[model samples]
Target: MFDKILIANRGEIACRVIRTCRRLGIRTVAVYSEADADAQHVRQADEAYCIGGPRPQESYLRGEAIIEVARQTGARAIHPGYGFLSENADFADAVEAAGLVFIGPKAASMRKMGSKAGAKELMQAAGVPVVPGYNGTDQSPETLAREAARIGFPLMIKAAHGGGGKGMRVVRVLDEFMASLESCQREAAGAFGRDRVLLERYIGQPRHIEFQVFGDVHGNVIHLNERECSAQRRYQKVIEESPSPFLTPELRAAMGEAAVKAAQAIGYVNAGTVEFIVAPDGAFYFMEINTRLQVEHPVTELVSGLDLVEWQLRVAAGEPLPLRQEQVRQQGHAIEVRVYAEDPDAGFLPGSGRLERLRLPAPSAHVRVDSGVVEGDTVTIFYDPMIAKLIVHDADRPRALARLREALAECEIGGPKSNVEFLERLVRHPAVVGASIDTGYLDRHLDEFMPAAEVDPDLLLAAAVAQLLAQERAARERAAGSGDPHSPWALADGWRLGHAGKRELAFVHRGAPLALVAHGSGGDYRIEHAGHDVVVNGARIEGDALSLRLDGRGRRFRVDSDPHRVMIHDGERRLRLEPVEVYRRQSGGSAGGEDRIRAPMPGRVVLVRARPGDPVRAGDEVLVIEAMKMELSLKAPRDGSIAEVRAAPGDFVEADAVLVTLEA
Candidate 1:
């Protein structure tokens, strides 16, 4: 093994690589951008260096700067952990040219598999089943349209060089073909620097199955079973699991053989993944090959009882295959869910801010958490907003799914809205629990997860009580610090001896103003709101949990709250409430009005569709804002003339910032 290796990426993957290198007695060096100066990965590594600014292009993507850091730290190899330059053939060649091991596949192998079109062609030559699609190099729009007509409707337009759900679109109608093609090409060129695309038949109710493939310099390649990544939203995998419920022993073996074939055909080295789309009839076709370690590798590791990173290092160090195909075994079932800083109800827009209070379920024999952030760390718009990967393993699929739901329920992430609650609901869904899922399941059944707009009285009471109790504690603490601990005014909350009838508290729950009246003091109080009186016998908050009693009924809820907002998680439902004053100031009455269009999240305006005095109708696309690498389009609220365009393309605006004002 090498003495030292540099991690050419940041975040959880970088930290994950460091742990394995330390185990193998290989010193690890970490490179960071300005935004990640105090990142967890940097603190975990033996040596660290700052390459450049916060943006990826300014730092993490700069291959030469990373190579220089590797040289300076005396690292003999560099691990490109799954993003940025991981699949870049030129960067892989540069690492080798600089006399440092790339710690992954060679440049030739990456080039052959980097382009989806090229990879499919190569797979076909190797006698591997491939999806029927147009992979030719024809750049003419007419040719692509003709190919789409030939392939039939409801086909997919995918960027030839794109991954991570970027630069992809589904054309369900003939008229949408041209528009979808343009959008896909634009996104493809912007994300991957390659505008070429391919057309494929869109498989309805197809399952996403990918096999973990490993290869050594000795020409030995083996498969590590498969992962079911069919549970997805917006073309991205939300949950991944090994030992797919849909796969039988015979089908598993066939897919495994095909995966190994694709890897060997490309002369792939180190760790890679061969993805396939499985039909309902157990027929499978090659999707594409991920040329580096995947985000969901932990599920594979847990089931296979092997450390893929260790294998990567061994293979890079010129070691032979660790185990043959027959020796490799999968012991149990493992499932992983990616918890991202995003709002599922609001089109799953990415959220960015300081994590004022972050708490994760403690890792145990059956549960593991891979995170790159801690409390107080800012989740900026500079990179992916994935907070952590929560993985759970058990003896069977049912137990693993149960454990995953429980783990997500115990997770507490404050300040930025997260999909933890959404994940929990998904796991508990009947279809999901029964293993009846597909790539479009989440999108198709999103409404089932999102509850009705009706408010729950218990949740509202809990939020009000918790906030009141917290405020009372703060008041007493401040009075004690002022040397007035004996004062009765400071000692009593909602019981000031003289003026004590009903103390009203105002809050906003899901945009509706709420008035809560508290009648009593100490731990006992009667909360009345909207003509509903809820007798609170007792209420107290311990960490992220809140124990409360309403009219002789006891309830315990997971509460993640700050001064401004409080999120109450009750089983599969999560309710977020904010202080009325804070909400008013943030929304400013014009948020839902027809007079102005405001940004839903903080992001840079990438496309401006309306100019001053331009007329637009309801649902007309007005602007497109990019945040955390995801684009959201703002639309006109109603038919009106654009009085003013407050933001232009390339301008960074905060959440609720007025982008365009309509004439009143």
Candidate 2:
């Protein structure tokens, strides 16, 4: 193995690679952008260097600068961890040209597999079953439209150079084809620097399953079973697991052989994934090849009992294959769920802020956490907002799914809004637990998961107790430093000298105002809110954990707080409660108007389709905004004329900033 290796990436994957390098006595060098100067990956590396600015264009994608860093640090090999430069054939070739080993596949293989169109052609040439679609090289708009017509309606327009669901669109009708193609092409060019696209027949009940394949310099290649990535949102995989519940032994064997064949055809080296789309009828079609260690590689590692990173290192160092095809085993089932710093209620828009308190579940023999951020770290807007990947391994899918829920409950992330609660609901969803889901499962049943935000009684109770506890603690700390510990001014709750009848406290949950009234004193209280009453026998707070007895039932809740906001974490749900200030005057002529269209989140306006006075109907795309590399479209709320366009293309606006105004 090489003495030192440089990781040409950031975030959890970088940290993940560093761990294996350390295990094998290989020193690791980490490259970071300005935004990631104090990032977890940088702190974990033996040596670190700043490549460029926060934006990927100015930083991680700079292959020449990264090569210079590798040279300066005397790194014998460079591991391009999944994202940024991982699949860039040019970058791999450049690294090798700089006399540093690229710890992945050969550049020639990457070039062949990098382009979706090229890969489909290669797969077909190699007799690998490919999806029936237009993989031709005709770039004319007329030709693409003709091909779309030939493929029929309800087809998919995918970027020839896309992965991770970027630059992909599903058109349900012929009328929407041209517009969808334009949108898809724009996204593809912006994301991959390639405007070319391919059309494929859309699978009605598709299931995403990919096999983990590895190859050594000795031309030995083997498969590590498969991972079911059917649980997706916005076409991106959210939950991935090995030993797919949808596949039988015969099907698994066939897919495994096909995956190996696909890898061998490309002369693949190190770690790569052969993705296939399985239809409802059990027929499978090749999707494309992921030419590097996938983001969801941990699930494969858990089931196969192999350190893929370590294997990659050994293979890159001119070693033979670690194990033959027959020796590899898929022991236990493993499930991996990505925890992102995105708000599920807000259309899952990516969130960026300081993580005040990030407490992941303690890793054990069954649970593993791969994260790139920690407490006090800031999840900036420069990159993916993934908080961590929670992986759980068990003997079967049912047990693994159960442990996934438990693992998510043990996680506590405070500051930016997260999708942990959503994930918890997902794992427990009937279809997921029963293993009867397709790629469109989440999209079809999104409403079942994202229930209307209402005042949860348990959450309210926990919040009230947390607030009371926090006040008492503050009072005690103040009294300790004062001259008299018994001073009435130091007491927190206003319950002295029988002066209590009905005390009211106001709060805001999920942006809706709440009025809570408590009757009685002396440690006993009857709380009323939203036509519901709860008898709180008593409550106690020890640190950030609150113990409360509501209606004679005791429960413990973990709480985190700031001055005005209190976050109550009960089981898998996290609720944020904001205390309403009594002294503040309520002056509003309606905070939001139906005619105004606001940018749901902070992002740069990428395109504006509606001009001033333009007529539009509800759900019409008025503008598009890009944030954290994902594009979101703002639509017209009702049938109206665009009264004004407040934002122009390339303008960066803050969250909730009005971007357009419509008039009836």
Candidate 3:
């Protein structure tokens, strides 16, 4: 519709918008920070510009700088893809004031829905069912405490202007109310630039259902069914699906109608999502409305057979509704899982580093991968640490689930730890398989989804074989160069005059020592471990797969390895193994006795709980840092006196930097 448009965001959403704009013959302009100078979005766009530094406030969130880029590139419209300034009403108004289309809802609509408290009040007036809670404008602490007492225990304290699971807390008891409130307000102030909060009655074991709502200037609004996002961890959706399996036809129609009402009440234009929390008894209440294209919109697109971005473009160009309410249809089931750069076992700590070996399932008609990164990209701590969104669609839910497992198996991520294995386990858990998962289920039953601490013997064996074979191959390749290829020392295949000497290899898995002795070579070997002997044949690595035969039985595994680490995926789970030297270095003895505390990940220091000369116990909170949209408290390792605090509040430190020092 327009000759050019600028994407006011980065990452996968920006890349996604560029694809649609390119398809429509519209030139796309991308703006990035210093950290993202070589980003995939920049390379893909027709024109690109560097706005500012790496941090969001320095670049992506600078509405004026982005507007200037659009003007310079001659972009007629700007797409604020889902995050950052997408929900900022002032930014939308600024764009319009600069004579460029915002490409989303009207500024008035955004302003009305910008605050959760205001949105809830508006929804209630529009006849949409809203949760019974406090949304009043009383800003005093005493008023909030009074409201909490009246509302009873187990209430939710949510930031009025925050999303993405930030600035939210659940208070379960009366005494814990003030502390939770303080924490929630502090986070809200830091993240959203506002400390205002709203109280809601916390619903236990609730299912998160959100309907995709679209509206145009013609005042026509329609619903695109609903997405079931109940599978979550810490209020963040882990997996999302369309046509909620828990929803009956009658309930679906009712919620869909109410979603339309909420959108119409705000005069929302372009694309938006109306989220609801449904209780077990079929009672649903309005949670909030996301005022732009959602991250999980692909699942809706796959099921509804429509491109939501294209619709956003047409709507911004003054086109009428693409189809009426009666014509909206959902064809099949679609599911999406967000793969993030995080460690699930380690308190879900977010990670950032170069993707040493990144591989994903090839995209096809039934499968799609929305990502802004590739194999060599570094997932800096400057923004969200999401790697990609893996989506799968099929004729039905069962088939879709089956395809998802296969697709997950094909993925192999190296370097920064990921939740891919955790997600794989979750999909097979009984509750997930039966479609009975709830928002708190993952947190309650997290142990069930975690792999056993001890690695499987078979898995360890595969790791040993893969490493030995790879080493032998490397030796042979070295021999072929400047040395004699026929030398037995170079081959190192247990060669001898009488009988081949057994080659002994030592490995470690989950802190357990593993010893293996191999005989023979060249894709054939007899291996011994734990006083047990077996014959292995056809052991070779092709790409990432390792196929081998042990004791006349065939086995296959996905192997990602280096001199330091060995990752073996045996169809269902991943096992981390390492050479004895590497393992020993990793399990360093000084880690626990270290006097200084290093920053776990790159982030800004938000609090220093202990100053120099302050006494603290082992479990006392010493400092707190926020990274990847979550807060991590650094605690004292042992009872000691703080000797120094290197960083202060608002100081951005790199990973492994010593931020605080204790008495040595």
Model 3 / residue 344 / CA error / Å: 1.5
The CA lDDT of each predicted structure is 0.89, 0.87, 0.89
* Superposed Cα RMSD, model 2: 3.9
Q: Tens-digit lDDT track for model 1 on 222-281?
A: 999999999988778988999899999999999999999999999988999999999888
- List the candidate 3 regions with Cα displacement exceeding 4 Å: 138-197, 496-499, 508-513, 540-544, 562-564, 581-594, 606-612, 648-652
Task: Output the better candidate (1/3) by TM-score.
Answer: 3
Name the TM-score of candidate 3.
0.92
Top candidate (lDDT): 3
Q: What lDDT score goes with residue 380 in model 3?
A: 88
- Give me the runs in candidate 1 sitting further than 4 Å from their true place: 137-159, 162-197, 471-486, 496-501, 538-545, 560-562, 582-599, 607-624, 634-651, 659-664
Clashing pairs in 1: none
